[model samples]
Target: MLEDAGGHVRDADDDQMRLECGVFGAWNVAESSAITALGLHALQHRGQEACGIASFDGQLFHTERHMGHVGEAFSGTDLVHRLPGRYAIGHTRYATSGASVIRNVQPMFADLEASGIAIAHNGNLTNFRALHTQLVAEGSIFQSTSDSEVILHLVARSRKGSMEARFIDALSRIEGGYALLALTNECLIGARDPLGIRPLVLGELDDAYVLASETCALEMIGARFVRDIEHGEVVVISGKRTLRSSRPFPAARARPCLFEYVYFSRPDSVVNGRSVYDVRKRMGACLAQETGVDADVVVPVPDSGVPAALGFAQASGIPYELGIIRSHYMGRTFIQPTQGVRELGVRMKHSPNRQVLEGKRVVLIDDSIVRGTTSRKIVRMVREAGAREIHFRSASPPIKWPDFYGIDMPDRDKLLAARKTLAEMQEILEVDSLGFLSVDGLYHAMDAGPRDPVHPQFTDHYFTGEYPTRLLDREIAEGRNDPVERQLSLLVTA
Candidate 1:
């Protein structure tokens, strides 16, 4: 769904937040770079910021990173033909926190070192700037503002010999959500952050083994789905053997980012062995439990919220109504040339059905509210449609914190709930009532069935101030994360 000039999709017939990224990788293969692009095309749903593919063919590495949609960037059949070799990794990105610039493209490579390290990453790192600054102080230079570059510098300085040992050691230094697909001439490595904020799964196709951000991508490339890469698991695909190591650690708490189920991931995919659709539907059901209401109709923001909206309607026995009509033909709004246009475009993208809202108390189910700009806009549209009363229900609890793990998003001030009470948000949006799902509701949506297997590396810092480990100090007096954020805090001085 990538737009031609700018990288965006036209919104068609829905008023839901589009999930933000798409990623894919293939290694130990006969045709690496070409196949990797195919994988990326499969994952085109995860990101649209930029597209890239890096391949290694035993002796040399090849790469192509374009500033626009994947097809437009790599469309020349001659170019695809020229992209030679077998072990490859590809990425499509959406700026998680940073702005969209060629400065933020992915699959960045460093070939000066013997085998080299090429990294394609999904998810934000809470402390990338800090890590980058530390590297720079120690005589390292950077080419892009991307956090993925920090990983390459770490690998470059990694203990000289083994790639696995070097990557594992450096992984300990990074704190945030990551599903990294890294390529070296000798190996293809897939590493997930301690919390597993993003999804990366394993699949097998013919003689080739694949790793991708979702099952849908694997299916698209005719790969057989294996299992998902577990939280904190690092799977290294070498020429002859696939090595995995998950041993070295004190037990870390698992609090996976709840947004994946609420709005981010593709509904057809699975994360942590759970179907995303089922999990989101459950969130909707949970919302219904908390906001049991007597309403004339139930309306869900299109696309992402449909599952939850369905659950809410079924749970409350209120008939579902298609109140919001989306313009599927509309291209992605953000990629619009101007910010004012983007803002105005959101309204043109989705329209409220006046017939459904007229004289009726309507229940609105949204996945989550980030800054409340989109929510407020939707409210205004609904009110203009003559809805008597609008009950707002968010499937997930409020997003009070920013994601450091590569999700392009607002800082603290942008979050409506971060600065105002739910009541305040309701008033600002001009809605009749607002209720959010509980934290327990979020966990249950992903936990599933009788056996709730918790991810070993999940971190819920967005909801809670909690985060992962650090370079330790034996003194029991005080402790904090490896100070990655503390180091980045200095950059604000610039």
Candidate 2:
């Protein structure tokens, strides 16, 4: 199920990459209807697998969950008019654990005998199997295989007196990254796991308090950016009050996943006040500072690599050119979540430009190389366009490990980098030369800023065979944290 979902697009601009899911939660004490709709649009880049929104009109809760983009699902007056309320929360999903089906679409909601609860989740848990086993042993039936659903069931089964206590209890049992938003009769709650593996920021629009995975969503709704929901912070906002509980909830606090900046987030986003685009560009500049042989023309794979390409060009003094043009008509695979739909989604999306590739030895810059299927295809396309030689360069180190965060990738058996060397990958991709930035290069690039270095990062198991943060690290061989590691200067001796 993980392998089949969440492909971004072929190369609309010559790059192929995966985007992690997005999360948006709004507590509209200001009573904004279209605000939630606009918030979904801002988060459109996060996940196209499915989109949903649940609103509370004080007395009743209304929800709209469907498989597609927000604009496509909630259309015209009929869909918008049905949801009228002073409080609303929304979600846009990219399938991680659960299969891509309408039945699995979220803002997942349920009505227990006592109260009805709605939730939108933006991360994955590592101990899902154990938790599922325990839950099923107690005979708590599951509606979907998604680890996210486990959270809802946990909350439902342990409904003590107050919803906050029940939610805290649910969070206590889970072991992984999550940025969750739950809406109920009296209030809205936003919770980020102790490690802060995912991002959930706080925003304000008049008297409204909105929670989202990125700052771009806040800008989309004209909401003023307030601050990041700190690592392991559980904040509850209502029409009348606001409350918060810090980390160390009888459990260890670890780290946030680093991919939120590298690939998952929109380039325009400012995660924890750090510019994601700037971070990626710095990574490229650092890479160029350390590497880059005598190359002909520097060309980015597209989209994700554009900023980095510019940085590399500036740093290396190599002229950056639009060497590869992408076919924008190609639709995104994440939009069509299911396997069958994705098979067709790729075809509908990317195409290569023959104009610049007709005769050139190009240095292709990309964020990271995962399975190498798309990379192989890209090289093939460039070759067919009459390129003399294609030198593939990755700004980040080869991703030899699969992510336990929200990204869905092929299993270990299918990950090319995990099983092969650079030469092996070059032979497979049919490239003249292939180079990836060292792990240390990427860290030096990201370390210049004033942000907390320990907040979170992708699981470094691929390069080091160890994890930067202990929260999501396990014996799984490969994996995907928040909080700083003071010992980062010690290089991983891979």
Candidate 3:
């Protein structure tokens, strides 16, 4: 269940760490809003809390933002008709920065002296609190608490000559991961951060140019996948169908989030030129090699674990089976507003199949263990189903650090691996054994060989605690009377 700004609770079960948002934009296309809606639908797994689309016709900009799934918000409505335009951008939000309020929904719009602009962002800003505090002190009025709103304020306050200049100016001052899509009357703009921590891909459909969080969005609209937007590069599609490219930031090595393959992105999506499904399967194969266990059957914790289980079974030469049946009708238990209900919701979502596990020694493959609460419950369920012995395998390395960029990871004290050893975790989960893929093993699966201790290839702070960007918020979080930390602790669980 989720709680909106109105303090009302609703059933929702998206338990994974929340991705900040998904963004899509198209330039010089008929019924641009409809195209954007389709793109957002394809990228729906990235976020599910709220969604919005903004389109710019020759005369005016039209917008529709709502708090719900993309299909429920955009299907069979005159809302598309209201947003007639040749250029548009859309966002699906998961609320990492602000409260679950209607005002916080994106395609955040602003009317500046230069022109009216609407922006949709896919990652978090690490220096948001400092910027927000400064902006508020300067008499800027904020419509919502979203960090993406800070970009608008920065652009509006810039002394730059044109909209593009102001936009670049705003991006330069910000630090952290971002894949941004902006729509204006004359152009549609797409940008990736200097480090390329988030993903943004370019695509082509007839005469139109497309920018989306993943290639799946392009596939949904029958667009041909182009290349990924380069780190620090900006592409602008003008009204006359002219495409211009610029590199505004200094050159830096790309480091896209590794978790996109492990859990966040849909298996069908391709990120940074690598197939997500292929990478996940490789992760499972690597896990099997790292710690191959003796078990009668390899069982997967349904859905997300399916691909990994296949790879594990293939590598270990053990038959794979669906030992846990997940109920698609059940909502994600993570969104349950209350602790009691959240725990109960897990049982409703998954059940063990006794027919597959009567007397077999089962090896269970899962993506990752966050708090170990759900894993513990799943182990108990398997035990009750008469499994002779249980062994748990995790596809990714131990998640020891909190994700400040976007993923809603628990605090250090709350993470199972952070507080306990591997043996301790096995005992706690009541499994015969527990194994996690090492950091180097994860890199090997990506075909990148072992990770460079001094210069890693990807942003994997969740496991390594080696953040790619400066943590300005960490300073505030460490303060004696820090409201930011308190608020984060409360909002993170929600």
Is candidate 2 or 3 superior in lDDT?
Answer: 3
How do the predictions measure up, each by TM-score? 0.85, 0.85, 0.92
Kindly provide the TM-score of model 3 when superposed on the true structure, using C-alpha atoms: 0.92
For model 1, the stretches where C-alpha displacement exceeds 4 angstroms are 1-22, 96-98, 240-251, 332-343, 448-458, 468-494
Q: Which ten residues in a row have the lowest lDDT in candidate 3?
A: 4-13
Ranking by lDDT: 3, 1, 2
- Alpha-carbon runs more than 4 Å astray in model 2: 1-20, 29-33, 96-98, 241-245, 248-254, 332-348, 448-459, 468-494
- How many residue pairs clash per model? 34, 15, 4
**Tens-digit lDDT track of model 2 for 118-152:** 88888777656656766788889888766778888
Candidate 1, lDDT over the whole model: 0.72
How high a TM-score does candidate 1 get? 0.85
**Winning model by TM-score:** 3
